[model samples]
Target: MDSADANIATELETRLSIIDTIERDDPSRRELSGADLSLFIGVSVVIVLFGILVLAL
Candidate 1:
């Protein structure tokens, strides 16, 4: 694979690992309440949709 392809793969792996860590219920990390979690879900969806819009443009 080319250098650009390798770089993109590495960045995606890093993001997935970070998400996995955040999703865990560890006390040391963020422990979102139900309301906060709902807000987060809404925000994440918004960001994803925005990204798709940018890509399409």
Candidate 2:
């Protein structure tokens, strides 16, 4: 009912709208999924094992 509360509500709505717009429009939000993480972990493990083998020889 108060002007202060109304101002806060308006500001919040605006910020939320901006966040929605950004999430809807931004491409950087595109991300690798679980399969990518699994492949990365597998590759890292292989590299570490190869390094260990090289060091042991």
Residue-level lDDT tens digits of model 2 in 4-37? 9999999999988987887765776667889989
What lDDT is reached at residue 51 by model 1? 100
Q: Name the lDDT value of residue 55 in candidate 1.
A: 100
Residue-pair clashes, model 1:
0
- Please give the CA lDDT of all the candidate structures: 0.87, 0.89
TM-score for all predictions?
0.42, 0.52
Which residue ranges in model 2 land beyond 4 Å of their true spot? 1-16
Off by over 4 Å in 1: 1-31
Local accuracy of candidate 1 as per-residue lDDT tens digits, 1-57: 999999999999988897778746656566668998899999999999999999999
